[model samples]
Every structure is written in C-alpha cells, then in structure tokens.
Target: MFARRALRAAAPAFAAGAAACGATTAWLADEADAGMFVVRPGLSASEYKPLVVGGVRQHTDGTTRVRFVMEEPDLELGAVAAAHLMAKASIDGAEVAGRVAPVSPLTAKGYFELAAAAAGDSAMSKAISSLKTGDVVQFKGPVQGFQVGRNQFKSVGILARGDGIADALQVATKLLSDPRDDTEIRLVYSVRSADQIVLRNHIDALALLHPRFKALIVADEAAPQWTGPTGPLSKPLLASILPPPTEGDSTVILVAGDVDAASGKATKARAAGVLGAMQYSPAQVRSL
Candidate 1:
C-alpha cells in the first residue's frame, strides 16, 4: 500500500534494442533504460530474459512467495532495499500496482511474498487472484519516502498484516543494517491463520540476531499447536507488544494495513494511544 509520490515526467527515452522479451510497448518516459521494466501489451506471454521467475511457493493460506532471478549476476539494484519497491503488474490487460516486500537477496536473485485476495471489487485483490507461476510482471521503483538516518528514533513500533509485514521488514532492515542506529524496534503483525505467517523464520532470525529487535505475531484463529496470542488486536495485545512510552518525541510507531488500520478509521483502535498516542496519515489507498 506504500505508493511513492509521482515525479515529473520526462521526454520519451528508449534504449537501443528495446525488443527484450516481455518488454512492454509503453515506458516511463526517461526511466525506460534506467532499470525500469515495462510489461507487454495485453500482458502477452513471453519469457523475460534478464528477469525470469525462478520459483513459486504457495502456502496453505493462499499466500504466494515468488522468486525472481536475474541472468546477469552483476546487476546493480541501486539503493533499492528489499520490500521497498513499488511494483506494477499487468493482469489480463488491467494494471495493478502494489508494494513488493523484499524477502531475501542474493547476488543474482530476489524474492517477494504476495497475498491472495478473494474475488471482489478491488483491483489489487483481483490482480492477486489472477497471478500464476511463470507470469511476466514488470516493476520499477525505490519509491521515495522516509530516509533512514543514524539514531533517528529511540524505539519504533511496527503494526502490519499479511503482506504488510514486508513493508515493516524493509524499515527494520534499514534501521538494523546501520549499526550506528541504536533504535529498538517492536513488530506486531496480525493474520487470520498460522499458514499466513510467511516470514516467521526470517523474523525470528532477526529477533535472535539483534537484541534491539522483537516480533509478536497475532493470529485470529490459532491451531492447537499455536503458542502466540490469538484474537483481534486490542489494548492488551498492544500493551504486551509495544515498548514503553518514551519521554521525548523520539519514539515513533509505524502501522501498515488496509486504509482503516493505516488511517485509524475503523475500531478507533489505533487512536487509543497504543504507542504513546502517536498518529499521522499522509494518504490512503482507495479500494476498488
């Protein structure tokens, strides 16, 4: 749901031999040759040479984690971190744009965890529903937003659900990667089923590796083997998950969810001072 602010369009710039397989007819003005990918017209079936789908893993809960590999091992992704790319996919002739959460990175490959949605009036949901293995999806970004600096905050709380965890992970990785940033982070993620916990192992590894990082996963319906808390997010859950309130304004809480959770519209839940009464909304992604 994290969309970048649109930049001013530049003159049409095409690279030499833009006839790469899966390359779309339209390009983003000046960025066509600058690591920007274009989808084929009518979402035609074609093998993207440099970028190809490597593996597709589907969880029991209908969420999918797809890996994209680059044939060129030396491809430079720029300052784009995992989970920070705003990707637009063409599905059945329709365009659906959403954030692609970075999972793991290798010299020549990357992974993204995507959620499945029930057929509804939402364009993104419909797009997610239409996705299949070997589909050619084009993405271009490192959408501009917050910049990670040294010691930006004393502690940070992240609230997310399903695919939103990728967004939270992006922020966490940025903070933790910088050893100079001593910001403690608390991640509270909500889900409907245990099978939907796609990044559990990775999250656990981060918590185990970093003393300043902690994660709490909440499930709406827990299987008998489940050990974590189970129920809708409420004050008690927030109390147990979030860090103590800070004396200064240095503490921050970043919540990621649908428009309601992000904007605190429904339940009046987030507005109840979950993380020291902090809240802000730059914009909301409207549903289809």
Candidate 2:
C-alpha cells in the first residue's frame, strides 16, 4: 500500500513533466522580477502629456478606496494599454509615486482609487482630499488595465519592480482555462521575440481546451519566422475583451523606447492579435 501510494503521488509529477516537455519552451525566471524592462533615465518626461480628469469614489477597504475613470478622455479609453502608466506627480518637488489600480463595478466612472502609506506625506492622499467632484487635477502615469478571470476581473496594475510579462500571461491563461465557461481574455504588449513564443504557445494551448477562446494579433508589421494572426490592433478586438466599455474591464499593455518605433510596434500588434494589447515599457514591466 505504501509503495502504491508513493507511485500514485509520482504519477502526477510525471504527467506534469511530460506536459512541460511537449509545451513550448517558456522562459521562466524564479526571481519574481523577471521580464522587466525599465525606462531609461534622461528620457525627456515631456514626451508624456499630463491629463486633468475626474476621479470617482469606489468602495474603500481599510485605507484604500477603489476609483475608476478613463485616464484620458479624448483618446478612446480602449486605446489605453494594460499595465501602462496613468500619471506622475511630485509633492513639494519630491517625486510622488503611484501605480494604476485595477477597475471594477465598485469603481465609478471618471474616478480611481489612490492610497498613501501614511496620511500627510503622500500626494495622492492630499489630492483625494482636496479634489472635489468634477475637479480636474494633473495626473500622468501608464494606461494600466485589467484581464478577465473566471468570475472576476484581473488587475492590470504593474509595479516597476514586479514580473510584468509573466504575470500578465499567467492571468490571461488562468482566466481562460479555470472556469470551463465561455469568456474572452484580452491582453496587449509591445512586441518582442521572446514574448511571441509565449503568446503562440498560450494560443495553441487554449485552442486545445476552448474553441470560444478566440484571439486577435495586431501589429504595425510582421516579424521574421512569426506564425500567428497579424494586423493593426483594431477597435473590434478591443471591444471583444472589454464589452460595454467600463474602466474596470479594460487592460492596456505598454512598451517604451525606440523599440516601439521599430520592432516593438509590429511585435505589439502581433501580440494584441493573440493577446490584448502590448503597451508596457521595460521599466514598467520590471516593476510588475
């Protein structure tokens, strides 16, 4: 009986190993900080435009209350990439840092949650208290967004120190498989060869399980040896993932650097066809 039990336990491990062998090679780093690309210093912040928008009060838990609103009103909120910046602020010339949090039903339109470690020192806290309804404040960060899960939505908020690509892929895959229901997971990213392999493998894997797990890849141009759907990521694909166009349901993936100008845009377009959108920079991903 003891031998039998031992063998039974080993069976699952053996199966897992076999699955991994057949699975496309995935570059997984254990540091929980892998796949991060950092923004280079000396890049003029002027490239970014700060937007003044309304923020809504969502539910508060502990010291944090979730808020939801489009980071930029003129731009179709769909254009915003997941895990990208929202705003940058400085208090008393001290750089005040905050990441975009995920959106949800509790999150009201034109508002998002901002928290501070304590009370007085954080600019977000001060802004939340001082700013009233319909008051516009200068805010600039990445166009962060979320993914769809089985029954819940995933958060698109990426820290400059967290695992970006891996985390996003994991969330997208889990959202598709675990539920055994009909649902779509949208993702976006700036294209890279390394990530293409992962995206292709993910699509192949999902195709085996869910026929409804449709995908769209959008890119400025095609890459060498690339094998997936390709196009300039369109509004139709964006609509599929974020039906009804609420802040809580959309996610944007941002990629920074001249890479976006070159292979990055093409890669992101490809990734968006299969995933959602590729919009995160290396620095932002590293913070994930």
Candidate 3:
C-alpha cells in the first residue's frame, strides 16, 4: 500500500496512458486537501461511459457481488497490483471506494469482480443499489493506499468486519501467492449472522491449502445449526486470534470495518487506514 501522493508523482504516466486510450489531453490534479485524484478537464465527468456489467449476484444474507468486464484492453491487473492501486466507482452519480477481487483463478480476458458490503445507507450502498446487468458504471483509480514493505514482516494479523473481509482477502491473496513471501497470515472475520458471511468457501479453501494461512469466523447472531464462536470480536477474541509479536517488528495488524469509532486511519487518500489505529498499537496497525 503506497501513498496516493506517490501515485500522483506518476500521474503524468497514467494521464498519458488514459489519453492514449481515448482520453484527450486529460489533466491530472492532486487534490491534496482531499488526498484524492481529480481530473481537471478533457475527460467528460458528466458522461456515464459503459463498462460491461457481466453479472450481479445477491447472497442469501444480502451481500452483493458485482462483476464487470474491464473493457480497456490495455488495463493490466498485474500492473495495478504492482502499483498498489485503489479505485472508486461512480454510478447514478454516487461515488464510493471499491476493492477489486479475483472472480476466477483463470480470469477470462478483462473480467474481475467488484465487491461492496452494502450494509448501510452509505455511498457504496447507494451506488450498488442501482446496479443492473449491462448498466455502465464509471471508475477512476489506480490510486495509491497504504504500503506494506516487501517481505517486511513475518506475520500479518487481520481483523475484519462486515464487507471489510474483502480487504483482508486482498492482502492475504498477495502475500500467499508470492512464493518468496513466506509471511504467516491470520484473519478474524466478524459478522452479524452466519448468513452474512461472504466468501466462506474461498477463504476456507485457502486456509486448507496454505499452511501459512488461518481463518476464523465469528458471528454476533448464530443460527441454531451453527457451531462456531458467537459474540462481538472484542479484545479477548482478538488476543486469542493474533499471534504474539516477534522481535524486529516482524508483525503487524491490519484492520477494516467500524474503525472510524476507534480513532484509527480508515484508508484516507494518503494516510494509513485502520492500520494506524492506537489500540492495536505497540504492534503496528493499519486500516484498509
């Protein structure tokens, strides 16, 4: 996770690429106060250009997963990963930050999934609420976020709630996929009910296959047939899940969801997200 400022420094290059891909002399401006990207002109802001919406799925628990085909043939998923890019979506004039996840191991051409928890009356929910197959949604990104060092830590502890599990998965996927990155990962997923748990099979499969990965799910309201831990993921739960920190600062905590109440960085355009929270401190912590 690199800072957005770093992405801005490379803005000229991004602008050039966008221009080559039907963008006309688009000017990139860093809204430093907002710590976000803003295209000054040349690109039509009012235009609702279409990106092929592949499909939309609603889970039994009300979570929504939207898949879109990246129409830009030049868009490289690997490049975005290497650059640590974060993106936002604009639909029905509502804009919200979104995270990209793998739809399939062997993605077909430029297809990927966009996930939103859509839990509350937030911008994300509003934008996602109106989504339909074939609707055109605009995206602006390749923006930067927190930067974790290359093999900097030996272990990562993730505490995620609600839709934030997507963020945890994003981090875990990167570290686990890198053969050279032998970092151990532990993830604690908290949700209101069993039905609310998303991507269980995927997470479970990763845990089963990867010796370095562990996943635990806690729900506030457990169904009669459910048998996992039940309760809020309070300090005690976290203490039990997180590994003790080793010397040389080889451990860090990454948090997402409901962090605003905890006075932690929450993926601000440039600042560390929940990773900057104080309670998880002494051990480094950041929000995604």
Candidate 4:
C-alpha cells in the first residue's frame, strides 16, 4: 500500500493528463475521504515507470489492493485509451509482469488489485504478491482490453470467486451510482465457506439498494444449515442466473478471481453469444 502523501503529490500529474485533452476529471468519492481514490492520468504506452507502494489492503483470500505513489510526483502520465498499463515487480531476484485493464481510464480506486495463487499458473502476479509498503513496482503501457470498444454495456453480469471480490467490490460500487437504474447487474459470487466471504455488509447493500441487482452467493462446502446456492461454480449454474446474450441486448459479463474461475465465465459467455465480454482478474485490476 502507498502512503497518503503520494496522492497529494500525484494529484497535479493526474490533472495534467486530463488537461491534455481539455477534459475536466470528475473525482468521485464515497466511503472514504475526499481524493483518497485519486484518478491518475494514463501512462505512456511505450515506457515503464517506477513507483513505490504507498499502502495496501489485504483480503482474507490473500488477494491485495496495492497503492503506488509515483517516485516523481511531478511526472505526467500521457493519456487515457492512448495506452493501458502493464505492471512488473521485482520479487526476490526474478521479474514478473502482467497486463492491467483501464479502470476509469486512469487509476482503479487509486490502488491495483493483485490476484491470488491460481490454477494454470497465469494471472498470478508473483512479483506483485511479494510487495509490501515501500516496495517499488514498474509500470509500462499500451495493451489490449476485453471490453466492447468503449460501449458501456447496459447490463453487467458478474461471476467471481472469493479471491476476486476485492476488485469486483470496487466495480460494484460504481454500478450502484450508474445513471441508468435500468442497468441490469447481477452477481454470482462463491467462496469456500462463510468465513471466506469478506465484505458482507457492502455486498448485501449492493443487492438491497440496486433495483435490478441480485446476488446468488454459494459455498462449495458449508455447514448443513447453510442455505444459499451450492457451488463448484459451473456453466450450468451460470445459465440459471444469466440467460444467453441476445443480439439486441447490450450485455457484458464480468469474470474475476483465479484463472480457472475467470476463464470459465469468459468461455461460457462467448459460447452463449456474449463474444466480447468485459473480463477482470485481480492481477489485472483497473481493467476495462
């Protein structure tokens, strides 16, 4: 996690990024102090910049939201959509790297989430996992995304495992404030057990307050009295919550967590006609 002063120093750089396009940024704040989740400008698509970890938020599943403060507070990140972020970290003596999506076309809540250990070995972000406060990470840019060409899908269906919720929770926060109440949003979240479910209050609030949002929470193994959707997290269960995407419906599926879990939803979505669904992995936070 980054220390607080980094945000104060980076604010000007963020302003410059927005200023380059004559666009004024709207910094949205809720649940935290003003400007805590500062939005920095997108970085140059060609180079890697070194940044220090200012702070970190740890989750029970071992995922983390890492906040980096620019070593050069005055440095400017070039532009948004002009480039996306690719992060690298030096863990032990080895180098690790991965692509990060454009969350808000800038920073994703001022910190990036690192996915936990995953199956198939992809999207694990080993370099990032070893980071602690004051650690340095390298960030480069100009990458691809999983969105539908800036068309914000009117409907969002989320399928995430416990390891992925750290970042998905942030996404859910934004959806709550969507101008379109008609935005159809749903979550199919699963964990190993009740103890594995973190941030229960916020999740409950999203379901209760959002007119069109619902959650089907399940546990793979639970006490006999536990009553919720049971999960191994499969395609059949997904079909039950979110129907196949129709030609005219503007829908996007969001997948996060381990590579296997995220891939399952992406694969299922593509097969169901949702060709270009928006995908998210903890390692690739601030994603499109």
lDDT to native, each model: 0.53, 0.34, 0.56, 0.51
Clashing pairs in 1: 83-102
Measured with C-alpha atoms, the lDDT of residue 184 in candidate 3 is 85
The TM-score of candidate 3 is 0.65
Indicate the residue-level lDDT of 19 in model 1.
47
Candidate 2: stretches off by over 4 Å:
1-150, 153-165, 179-182, 187-196, 227-288
Query: TM-scores of the models, in the given order?
Result: 0.61, 0.29, 0.65, 0.56
Model 2, 179-227: lDDT tens digits are 4433444444323332222224444565566654444444444666556
Please say which candidate is ahead in lDDT: 1 or 4: 1
Candidate 4 residues lying further than 4 Å off, grouped into runs, are 1-42, 59-63, 71-84, 101-129, 142-154, 160-173, 189-205, 217-231, 243-248, 254-288
Model 4 quality (TM-score): 0.56
Cα lDDT of model 2 overall?
A: 0.34
Residue 239 accuracy (lDDT) in model 1: 67
Give one digit per residue, the lDDT tens place, for model 1 in 129-159: 4566677666554343344344767877777
Sort every candidate by TM-score, greatest first: 3, 1, 4, 2
The C-alpha RMSD of each candidate to the native structure, in angstroms, is 8.5, 21.9, 8.4, 9.0
Q: How many residue pairs clash in all the candidates, one count each?
A: 1, 64, 12, 10
Preferred candidate (TM-score higher): 2 or 3: 3
- The TM-score between candidate 1 and the true structure equals 0.61
